[model samples]
Target: MSFSKIFGGKKKEQAPSTGEAIQRLRQTEEMLNKKQDFLEKKITEELKTARNKGTKDKRAALNALKRKKRLEKQLQQIDGTLSTIEFQREALENANTNSEVLKTMGYAAKALKNAHQHLDVDDVHDLMDDISESMDVSNEISEAISTQPAFDTVDEDELLAELEELEQEELDEKLLDVGPSVSDRLPDVPSEAPAHREKAKKVDDDDDMAELAAWAS
Candidate 1:
C-alpha cells in the first residue's frame, strides 16, 4: 500500500508550539466559559419555572427541577474543565517564561566570560593594590603640602623673654633722653604768703631806724 493510503490518505498534524498551545487553551477556556454561562442561565430559568409551577403542576415542576439539575451538572463539568485548562495554561506560560529567562542568563554568562577572557585574577589584584598604594601616597603628599612649617629648632618662651627685655631697655633710654619736668624748670618761691613777707620786711626796717636813733644819741 502507498504511504498515504496506509495513513488513511491524510497527513498527521504538526505538534503545536508553546505559544500556539497556550492560544488554543485560551480559546477552549473562552468556549467553556460561554457554555458555563449558558448553562447557568438555563439552570436559573428552569429553577424559576419550577418555582412558578410548584403545587400547581407537580409533573411540570418536577421536570423543570430535573432539567435544572441537569444544566447545573453540565455547568459544574464545564467549570472543572475550565479549571484544568487554566491551570495547564498557567503552568505552560510559567515554564516558557522560565526557559526564556534561563536562555538570557546563559547568554549573559557567556558574554561575561568572554569579557574576562583577557583578565587574570592575580594581575587584577596587583593592579588594585598598586592603585591603593598610589592613593595612599597621594594622600600623604597632600597632607604634607597642607601642613604648616615646623618651628622645632626655635625656643618660643626664651625668644619672648628676650624681646620683652629689649622693649624695657628701649623705654628706659627714651626716658633718659627726655628733659626734666615743668616743676623743676620753674624758679623757687617763698614758703610763706606774700602779705606775711611784706610785714616782716616792715618790722626789720623799723628795728633798723630804732638802732640808728640810739646810736645818734
Candidate 2:
C-alpha cells in the first residue's frame, strides 16, 4: 500500500469537447421540445373535456379546467428549458468553429515558416548582386563585340566635307558639258540679209527707167 498509488489510483474523467457538448445540448433541446408538445396535447384534451362537461356537469368541468391549467404550467417550464438549451448549443457551436479556425491558422503559419526556412535576407541580397554582376559582364561583352577592329569608325565632319566636294565636282562637269552645245546653236555676229535685199530693188528700177527712155526716143 504505497501513498502515491492510493492518491493517483483513479483515472480522471475526460471533459466533453466543444462539438460533443453542442450535440448534447441539441439533444436536450429536442427532448424538451417533445415534452412540451406532449404537454400541449394533454392541455388540449383537458380543455375539450371541460367544454363537453361544462353544461351537463359543472363539477366535472371545473376539475378538467384545473388539469388544463397545471398542464399549461408544465408546458411553459419546458419552453424555458428549451430556450436555455438552444442558447447553450449555439454558443458551443460557435466555440467549436473558432477552435477549428485557430487550428487551421496555426497550421498555415507553420507551413509558411517551413517554406521560408532556407531563405535569408543576406542570401537574397547576394543572389541579386550576382545577377547584377552577370548582367554587367554581358553588357561589356556585347559592347566589345560591337566595337571590334573589323568595323571602321568614320569621322562625321570628314564624311560631310567629302559629300560636299563630290556635289561641287558634279556641278562643274554639267556646266562644261552644256557650254559648247549652247555656243554652237548661236547665230553669226554680222548679218547680210538687209544689204542684199536693197541691192536687188535698185537694179530692177534702173532697168524700168532705161525702157522708158528708149520708148521716148
Candidate 3:
C-alpha cells in the first residue's frame, strides 16, 4: 500500500551483456532478411503489374512503380542497418576473443615465473659437477680397496738357485739311505756263505763216520 512498496521497491533492470547484444543483432538481421525477401516479391509483382498495364492503365502502373521504389528504399535502409549491427557484433566478438587470449597468456607467464623461482643455472651446474666428482671419487676408492696387494717380487735367478739347493739336499739324503740299505744286504750275503761252508763240513764228517762203521761191521 505504501509508495516504496508500489514503485521504489522494484529492482532496476540489469544492463545487457555482450552475448545478449549479439543475439539481438542476429535476430534483427533475420527479421531484416525476411523483410527483404517480402520486398523483392512485392517488387516483382509490381513489375508484372506495370508491364501488363502498358498504356491501358498509366496511372495505376505509375502508382505501382512508385510503391515499388518506396519499398526498395526501405529495404536499402534495413540492409544498411543490418550491416551496422553485424559490424558491431563482430567487433565485440573479436574483442572478447582477444581478451580471453591475453588472459590465458598472462596466466601461463605467471606459472612459468613461479616454476623458475627456485631454479638457478649456476646452482644446477654446480650440483651436477658435484655429483659427477663424487661418483668418480667413489669409483677410485672402490678400485683402491678391491685391488689385491702385490707380493714381493723375487729374482728369477734366486728362485732357481733355491730350487736347485733343495734338489741337491734331497739327493744326498737318498744316497745316505741307499748306503745303509746296501750294507745291510751285503752283510746278509756274507753270513749265508759262511753257513753254506759249515754245512758242507758237517756232511763230510757224517760220510767218514758211516765208512768207519761199515768197516768195523
**Cα lDDT of model 2 overall?**
0.89
Q: Given candidate 2, what's the lDDT at residue 110? A: 100
Per-residue alpha-carbon lDDT of candidate 1 for residues 71-160, written as tens digits (9 for 90 to 100): 888888888888899999999999889988999999999999999999999999999999999999999999999887786567889999
TM-score of each model, paired residue for residue: 0.63, 0.65, 0.50
Query: Which candidate number maximizes lDDT?
Result: 1
Ranking by TM-score: 2, 1, 3
lDDT (C-alpha) at residue 80 in model 3: 92
Best of the two (2, 3) by TM-score: 2
| Runs in model 1 lying further than 4 Å from the true structure | 1-15, 49-61, 147-154, 177-217
How should the candidates be ordered by lDDT, best one leading?
A: 1, 2, 3
Please provide, for model 3 over 80-164, each residue's C-alpha lDDT reduced to its tens digit, 9 standing for 90 to 100.
9888988998997887778789989999999999999999999999999999999999999999998876775568999999999
The TM-score leader among the candidates is: 2
